[model samples]
Target: MKKRFLGYPNWWGEMPMAVYTFIEKHDWEGRTIVPFCTHEGSGLSGTERRIQSACTGAKVLKGLAVRGSAAQHEQESVRKSVSSWLEKLHL
Candidate 1:
């Protein structure tokens, strides 16, 4: 994957309004969406399902949830996990 990173600086139980708005306005039918998020504790907070529902016909792949703590202090570990996740996704 040439451009594969999606980072969320904060997680207050949902995606930023801009992201949802983008999803609402875009044509996602039959497209594939991969969700990745950084969280302190809540993990992905069901974003995969939310994206799938909002996108109608889109295929939502299994998401990656990297803890903000790990990303800040255990970056190498987070990198390995992210790499493994993308490999599994065939990206």
Candidate 2:
């Protein structure tokens, strides 16, 4: 993985718009974007698709969505899950 990151401001039920705005404000051509998030219950919620559509020139990978509660109370499990996800992606 290269030393690059794209961080977007997100809110529940607002990820699609946020991603669109992010894409509009930035240039992600020829880059691989991995989206990850912590949500209460709406896991990913088609945000991956939105991201792909918004950033048409970038490759959007399958993302990991952690439940906010699980992340808060099951730190070790979250860590393991994230590690596994990254490993699967060969990152």
Q: Please, what is the TM-score per model?
A: 0.83, 0.82
**Residue-by-residue lDDT tens digits, candidate 2, 1-91:** 3323444433673474655665789877788888887787778777788877877588888888888789889999999999999899888
- Largest lDDT belongs to which candidate? 1
| lDDT, model 2, position 35 | 85
Candidate 1 C-alpha lDDT tens digits along 1-91: 1222334534766878787887788777667777888888888887777878888777878889888889899999999999999999989
Clashes of each: 0, 0
Candidate 1 overall lDDT versus native: 0.78
Off by over 4 Å in 2: 1-13, 16-19
Query: lDDT per model, in order?
Result: 0.78, 0.75
For model 2, the local distance difference test gives 0.75
